[model samples]
Target chain A: AQTVTQSQPEMSVQEAETVTLSCTYDTSESDYYLFWYKQPPSRQMILVIRQEAYKQQNATENRFSVNFQKAAKSFSLKISDSQLGDAAMYFCAYRNSRTFGNKLVFGAGTILRVKS
Target chain B: NAGVTQTPKFRVLKTGQSMTLLCAQDMNHEYMYWYRQDPGMGLRLIHYSVGEGTTAKGEVPDGYNVSRLKKQNFLLGLESAAPSQTSVYFCASEGTGQETQYFGPGTRLLVL
Candidate 1:
């Protein structure tokens, strides 16, 4: 079974600064997909970004980018130019590309606080 | 399109009581999933449907039963509620190979 781990339970970043949330996974599959999800206080789950294991280049989405290292099985999310609106619970998820249902195995989560 | 929607935004039930959570997607997605979220425990898959008339158990499907009689709707049922089952339930759907699953707003279930 594949598992994702987010070691940091909480992280804080000052406004306009950058913060990196660490994530590691245990997967034997060579090809898979990783994602970062943000859950706000309203309980809405939003997709922050994604990375494909086969892609060497990290994925970047505006202020959100990922550092995906396949050999190390590490996928970390970096939020730059952080804003107060970035406060939320961030989750790291793993999925098998060949598997059915696209079921996601998620980490416990990291609570991100953006300080103004 | 409403994307994904779960019926009964919130509900409180007692032990032994039974209820069904309805999840509907207007995107005509081919797959649907039911998951439970608890504090400190991101989310665990309870059940999933590959398509209409096809349902399968997920990581934590023991106490949950699901039916997908319609392509656009999936229903999860708890025959008898338990306090341990008290958690926020989420429903998600995606087209085959889409790589991204759209989640519902979630149903807050409280069992006492």
Candidate 2:
């Protein structure tokens, strides 16, 4: 079984600043995928960024990037130039690529607050 | 196109009452999943379907039943509601060869 952990329950960042949310997971599978999802007050889940375990390079999507350390079993999400819209509950998820169902295992979550 | 939609955005039920939540997707996805979200718990998988008529239990399948008779539709049933079952339920679907799972708005259920 795979488990994802987000140590921080609440985080706050000033507008236009940068913020980093930490995440760690335990999995024995060599081939897997890591993802960051955002949920706003609207209650809609949105994909922020994703990283493949096999890829040594981190994944970057515009202002959102990920720091993936496979050896340490750590995957952290970084948001640059943070805005009010970035205030949401962020979740880290893991999925085994080799599995037939490809079910996602998610972390408890980190509540992000953007201060103006 | 409607990616994924869940019927009855909100509902309240008394203990021992039964109800079903419907989920539909228009992306021609091959997989569908049901999950429940609590205050501190991010989300727990309840049940999932690999294909039409093929359903499997997930991490938290107790007190929940699901049916995937049609490829695009998946229904989650609560045979006997309980206060513990009060939470937001979400439905997701993934297309073939895609790792991303599209989520629906979600259904908020409160069991009194």
Candidate 3:
């Protein structure tokens, strides 16, 4: 069984500043996928960024990026130039690449507050 | 196009009451999943379907049942509601070749 952990329950960042949310996971599988999802006040889950375990290079999507350290079993999300819209509950997820059914294992979540 | 939609945006049920939540996707996805979200718990999988008529139990399948008679429709049923079952329910679907799952708006369920 894979388990994702988000140590920080709450985080705040100044507008236009950068923020990093920490995430760690325990999985025996060598190949897997890591994802960060954002849930705004609307409560809609949206994909922020994703990283493939096999790729040594981190994944970057516009302002959202991931620092994936496979050896340390750590995958952290970084939001650059943070805006008010970035304020939400962020969740880290994991999925095994070997399985055809892609069931995601998610962390408790971190509440991000972007201050003006 | 509506990616994924869940019927009955909000539902309130009493103990021992029964109800079903419907989920439909228009993306022609082969996999559908049901999950419950609590205050501190991000999301826990309740049930999932790999294909039409093939359903499987997920991490938290107790007190819940799911059916996928049609490829695009997935139904989650609670035979006997309990206070513990009060939580927001979300439906997700993924294509056969896609790794990312698309989520619905979610259904707010309150079991009194």
Candidate 4:
């Protein structure tokens, strides 16, 4: 079984600043995928970014990027030029290979607050 | 496109009552999943379907039943709702391989 852990329960960042959310996982499988999802007050979960375990390079999507250390089993999300709209619950997820398509094991989300 | 949609956005049920939540997707996805989100506890997979008429148990399938009579729709039923079952439910669909999952807006259920 794979377990994802988000140590921070809540985080706050000043507007226009940068913030990093930490995530770690336990998985014995070598081939997998890591993902970051955002859940706003609207209760809609949206994908923010993704990283393939085989790729040594980190994944970046506009202002959202990840620091993936496969050896350490760590995948952290970084948000740059953070805005008020970035305030949401951020989740770190892990998915095994093809046998399970997108069945993600998510961490207890980190509630992000953007302060003006 | 409406993407993924779950019916009855909000519902309140008394203990022992039974209800089914419906999830539908228009993306022609072959895989559908049911998950429950609780405060402090991340999303837990309840059940999933590989395709039409094929339902499989996930991490937490207790007290929950699911059916995918049609490819576009997956229904999750709770027989005898309990207070422990009170949580927000999210339905997701995805294509084969490692494609990203598209999630529904979610259904908020409160068991009294």
Evaluated with DockQ, which candidate comes out highest? 1
lDDT of 4: 0.95
True contacts kept of each: 0.73, 0.54, 0.61, 0.73
Q: Candidate 3, after superposition: displacement of residue A18 in Å?
A: 0.3
Tens-digit lDDT track for model 2 on B1-112? 9999999899999999999999999999999999999999888999999999999999999999999999999999999999999999999999987888989999999999
What TM value does model 1 have?
Answer: 0.99
lDDT of 2 by residue, A19-43 (tens): 9999999999999999999999999
**Residue A82 shift from truth in candidate 1, angstroms:** 0.5
Candidate 4: the clashing residue pairs are: none
How close to the true structure is residue A109 of candidate 1, measured as C-alpha lDDT? 99
- The DockQ of each candidate is 0.85, 0.76, 0.81, 0.78
State every prediction's TM-score relative to the real structure.
0.99, 0.99, 0.99, 0.98
In the order shown, the candidates' Cα RMSDs to the true structure are 0.7, 0.7, 0.6, 0.9
Superposed by TM-score, candidate 2 places the C-alpha of residue B38 at a distance from the truth, in angstroms, of 0.7
Q: Is candidate 2 or candidate 3 better by DockQ?
A: 3
lDDT of each: 0.94, 0.95, 0.95, 0.95
Candidate 3 docking class: high
For model 2, the superposed segments whose C-alpha errors exceed 4 Å read none
Could you tell me the lDDT of residue A40 within candidate 4?
Answer: 92
Give the fraction of true interface contacts kept by model 3.
Answer: 0.61
Kindly list the interface RMSD, in angstroms, of each predicted candidate in the order they appear.
0.7, 0.8, 0.6, 1.1
Candidate 1 ranges with C-alpha deviation above 4 Å? none
lDDT of 1 at B69: 96
